[model samples]
Target: MTPDDLADSELPMLSAAQATHLRALAAPHYREGHQYSLESLAHTCSRAPEEHWPDLVAAHFDRLRQASQGDESAEELLRGVHARLLPVDSVPSELLGSLRYARVVADGLVFAYALDGPTSVRLLTDRDVERAGLQALGEAARANLMRVPVRHEEVGVEGGARLRSVYGDSPFVAGQALFLAEVAWKVVGERLPDAGALVVVPTRHNLVYHPIADGSVVDAVNSLAAYALGAHEDGPGALSPRVYWWHRGSLTSLTVIDHETLTFSLQPPPHLLGLMKGLVHLDRAGRLATRAAAEPAGLEELMRGAAESMDRLVQDPATLADAFRSLVSLAHARCAYDPDVAHIDTWDAWATATRLGSALFTGAPAQECHLGEDLVWQLPAFPAEPPADARGWLDALYLAIVCRQTDRIGRLCRVPSETLRQDDSVDEYVLHWIDTLRAYFSDGPSMDDVVEKLVATIETSGRDGVTHAPTEFVNAIDYQPAALFHRLIARDHDTFAKALAEAVAEHGGYWDGSAAPRARVALGPLAMASLAYDYGFPVDPAQPCLPAHLLNRQRLEEFS
Candidate 1:
């Protein structure tokens, strides 16, 4: 009988002709009732195509017959055994004696030990567990499960929640959630909040989790629950359709199922609710403080407020890097546009950002870039690796080159242009600018090639009037390369000066009526001018975007 015939019947039973065929295909050692029950045969047939039913049934019976004899020694069995998670009530009462060693780990889930083979998985029986010793077997299973290689990726969920998914083709992937704490530390490190995380093991090959941080936990719970149900239903080795709270190494079910209605919903316990509420309150407070700091104000006051509120405003390494970029932008704006703002004030902001960035990214303290303290090119221990975000890496490379720090520039260049292209958010023009700077600094390509690429980008961007960069940043992205190429490679002082003025105007327009300190400067133009001034290009000290005090580099000479 076909699979559809079995599905339409009240009892999934094989017909006489099908039974005869299955019996003929059975292994020589297969016993009729013990190793090849009619019910088991029907179930296997329903899940596989009729064309391959013979081989499948033959292999299934052979596996059962081999498992029944238990020829392998306990030591050999322990080597391949691993923890397996199964749906609740999946084991029949008659087979319960064999799986008595299994324990309930969470709602709708049973954790059991199994010997994973190339072609099949054999669930350990109570007799096998007794011989291996429960403690030794448990340890061996966990160790074996952990050995499986898993890939990690971060995905953004709706409502501003981020989920980390760890998956593998191995059948024991879901069981790794049993040791979620260790995995969280290995993958998340300092990013995992003190409150722990929300977790879901949907199928034998997938586990997704969100580190509990703020009010977004509510959205994360709903998203994870929906994902779990869908993945479980589509699974080759389905495990659970429930969400669980993983707190301090403990897993508790967060899903509540209505048996009568056959539906499920997530409901966090009181303790978890209280924790989430507290995080929500803090999140709101931090946002309010950031808003206050962004109000119309003097650059120094705004910088001071930002530095003070950083701990509350920044949540992760990514945000910390962004905060540093914001501060750098503000320092550039102040130096370029606000002549009244002291160069020392701009240096102070840079020093503060560098210190915070160093602490966060490198776990090192940076020496203060004080006024008249000869610029120490290497005082701050830069992060060994560049930021993964294309924009952040660009900002870092700009700072390194403008400061004339060869070591820092070399470190940043280790990241190839192709790696930066992976971030789709960055504009093509911005990437071209990065490539030009990398090639120029490293002497990797001819200056003519760089100029040709820059001119082509400018022509294309001007013709299309379209850019991949965000609306607020399009002008800055367009103007940075033009200004840098003119000053550095073309040696066209007049063109460089014009490009600088346009960049300054674009910066002002972008930050018009904004109270944030970063609105005061155009960092890209200032960096380009710094390079020109160093190269003895007669830059107009009174230029709108090039602050004279900063161009002199007297402060930078203090370290010398």
Candidate 2:
């Protein structure tokens, strides 16, 4: 049944003429198990105004008839085929027969291929796939789909949440969610948050998404769900009436359907629930950090707020590694804005990040890596696999180095350097820096070799670059860490201090008007400074990004 049929009490009563036209259209393709039964046709056209039923039915069949002719050359077919997301039940079961014609994508959705023409899109049958000699039809269709032009409008909602709706006259707009990461990046550029996004493809022409950055997601979910249900009910081309969580290229349905009752509700799975809780915690911590920075006299009260947020986050074992990375950013912001009052707060945040990072990455208990203690010496076994993204690997490496756990560093370096090169999403320059740092910390390369590789990476990154004021450097974040790493390994103390200040200043300028807490400070540069300070290198304590207390591990010494 179509989405509207699930909600309506009865399908629109079909006139004799409409019934005859539908049957005549279905006759050539009619088989016992096909989806073209009289009832199914009525359901399909039910959402359209009754007056338009005949045209809609005839147009759908016309496209199918054209698709069945299959006389186009393989190259022409490949160029015209595009992936479409549709409700699973909308496609004929007979067409799906063992041939990879349709594959289930989300809970009630399927990824199907279609041939696009000027006036209509035709669903490809098994015959179309055979004619094209395609072994991986889905892959080819998806590749072609990405070439479609993407356009979106940003809609700001209540509670500081923002939604980006990708909509156009193009029939392929809603299917862009299948390539969500690339589409989102294209639409929002670097502004898309690292925690991923919450998406709803309400109708075939509209895909709405909210990047998961703050506590607003709690409300955005309900808002998007209501929007989806309404749009699905009013559609000429309805897809799934559900919300999905898109993270690291994987899509998970966040809407649960109770088929028996013909009802559905939004309920995030365990992993997504954990991520949502993490976002909320980070949001609260960020507010407290901002307040503390702006009002240093109320530091104690703000610290209490920070403690409360941390307590709640600590209680959830599913809190993601990215959350801790944000926490580290908040900690560095406190040091940057009000170092004198933030000494203890900075240590607390960093210690918590290291403790949580150990637990999340190594599968160790948080208690084992207690706060206010010398960093744990007995490092747990590092995972055999590297993290899925550059930031994750960097977070892991930062935690290991800050805690002065060289054994963990060695273990991290052993997890296949080739894995770092696999993800095309990561900048090649960033990967070079990560590999160099891993080699430096593992003692696999001499300090000279490390400096040489890092310098080359930074110089190459800046060669075609625009310089941010205060320094002749590239504005990209990926290369800043490398620039700092080069300064440190070469022991160029003056340039290191100069670069640190410039990097911190550039960071603030880059995210100047943004509300994301992750924008407040440069975690990467601070992490690199922490390494230098640990090695007895002279680090200017007052550098805004490098919290002096954190660099010295002051609270660990005092409290222990």
Which candidate leads the pack in TM-score?
Answer: 2
Candidates' C-alpha lDDT: 0.63, 0.62
Regions more than 4 Å wrong, model 2: 1-68, 98-101, 135-139, 190-194, 287-537, 541-560
Which digits, one per residue and each the tens of the lDDT, describe model 1 over residues 286-326? 21112113244455564554553454333333445545654
Least accurate 10 contiguous residues by lDDT in model 2: 465-474
Error in Å for residue 346 of model 1: 12
Clashes of 1: 7
lDDT of model 2 at position 209: 92
Clash pairs of candidate 1? 330-518, 332-521, 333-520, 333-521, 374-558, 374-559, 375-559
- Candidate 2 achieves a global lDDT of 0.62
lDDT of 1 at 181: 75
- TM-score result, candidate 1: 0.48
